[model samples]
Target: MHLIYLDEAGNSGTNLDDPHQPIHTVCGVIVKDSQWLPIETQIDALIAHLVPRVADREGFEFHNSDIFQGHGFFKGWPWPTRVDALERLLDIIVTNKLPIVWGAVDKQKHKAKYVYPAAPHDMAFLLCAERAERWFKNHAKDDVGMFIADDTKAKSDMKKSFKEYRKTIALGNRKECLEHIIDTIHFADSRETFGISFRMRLTISSSGILWAPLELSPFLSELNGMYMQEGCFRKKGAAK
Candidate 1:
C-alpha cells in the first residue's frame, strides 16, 4: 500500500481575516510502503546531522516554521546553516522520487466567490484527497493508499470533512471519488512521525512558494520535479 502522509500550513479555521495567513495549504507526500523505511532513515540521519550533541534524537521534529525562523531546536543556528538543513531534507524527497500532492486555497478569493465558502481547511483537504485518490488509480493501480495527517487543532473538523468525502463525490465538474484511499485518515503527532515531519516541511515550503514566490523561487524550482503532474486535478485549460 502507498501511504500519503499529510501536513498543513496557514490554517486559520473559518476565520479568513488573518492577514498573515491569507492562504491555507495542505500537502501530502506519497511513499510506497517499501520506500518508507529508507525515507525515515534519511530523515533520522539529517536530524542527527542537525543536532549531533543530543544523545537521543527521538524528540527532534523537523518543523519548517521553526527551522526557517531559527526557533526551537533550530534556534541559534546561522541562516545558511538552516537553509542548508532544509535543502538537505528536500534532497531526501528528490532522491527518493516521492510524489507530492498538495492543495492550496486563497482565503479572500474563496470567501468572496462562494455564497457560503467551505473553510479553507475543508477545501484544501478535499483537493488534496482528490489528487491522492488519483495517484492510486493512475500510478499505483494495483495498490491501495492510506492517509495520515499530522495532528492539529482542526482535527475534529477535518475528520468530519474526511467522512463526507469518502461517502460522496467531491464538489466539482467531474466525479472525484476517494475510494482508492482506504480507511479514515490517521492523525499522528508530528514530533513522533518522521513521515508527518517530512510532510510539515513540504506544506510550509509549498505555502512559502505560493505567498512569497520571489524569495522562494529557488526552492520552488527544485520542488517542481516532485509534484505528481498527471495526478493533478487541474480544471480544463488550466496551466500546468
Candidate 2:
C-alpha cells in the first residue's frame, strides 16, 4: 500500500482573481507504507541538525513559507543560510527517490476559459488525485493508495470535491473515476505528521513553477525529476 501526503499552496478560495496569488497548487508525495518510518526518521534528524539549539524539537513544524520569508524560527537568519536549509530538505526527497505529483491552476486563464470555472482548489485537488491514481496504475499496479492531506479550514469543501470525484466523472473528463485511491482523504495536522510536513515544500514550489520559475529554478529543477510525468503538471487541464 502507498500513502500519499497532500498539501496545497497559494489557495485564494473562490476569489480566483486575487492579484497577489494568481495560481493555486496542490501537491502529493507518494510513499510506500514500508518506507514511511525511514523517511520520517531522516526528516526528524534533519530538523534537529538545522535547529540544534531548540530543546523541544517535538513541537517544531517546518513551514516552507516561514523558512523562505524569514518568519518564525527563520527570522533574522541570513539569506544563504535559509536557502541552504531548504536545499537540504529537498535533498531528503531526492535521496529517497520519492515520486511527486502536482496540480497547479492559473486562476486568470482558468476563469477566462470557462463560463462557470471550477473553483481553483477543487480543480487542483481533482487533478492531483487523478494523477495519483494514474501513478499507481502505472508503477505500482498491485498496491492500493490513500491520501493523508494537511487539515485546512477548507476541509469540508475539499471533502465535497473529493466525494464528487470518487463517485462521478470529474473535471469534464469522462476518463476520470479515481478507483485506485482507497476511501476518502484522511486529513491531519501538519504539526503531527512528518509525511505531510516534508511534502509541503512541493506545494509551495509548484506554485513557483507557474508564478516565478526563475526565482525558484533550483528547487523546481530538482523537483522535476521526482514529478510523475504522465500527467505532466496540469494547468487548466493542459499538460506542461
Clashes by residue pair, model 1: none
Q: Write the per-residue lDDT of candidate 1 for residues 1-240, one digit (tens) a residue.
A: 888999887888789878877878888888899998888888878888888877756578778888778898788989888778877887787788778888888888888898999789888888888878877777887888888988777678777788889876546568776778888888888888778777643333323353321333344444545463322223334454
Model 2 is weakest, by summed lDDT over 10 consecutive residues, at 205-214
For model 2, name the residue pairs that clash: none
Q: Residues 78-179, candidate 2: write the lDDT tens digits.
A: 977877777777777777778888887888888889999989988888888888887888898788988899988888887788888887555554666777
Measured against the true structure, the TM-scores of the candidates, in listed sequence, are 0.85, 0.85
Number of backbone-clashing residue pairs for each candidate, in the order shown: 0, 0
Model 1 lDDT at residue 85: 81
Over all chains combined, what TM-score does candidate 2 have? 0.85
Compared with the true structure, the alpha-carbon lDDT of candidate 1 equals 0.75
**Candidate 1, residue 8: how far the Cα is off, in Å:** 0.9
Deviation from native of the Cα of residue 24 in model 2, angstroms: 1.1
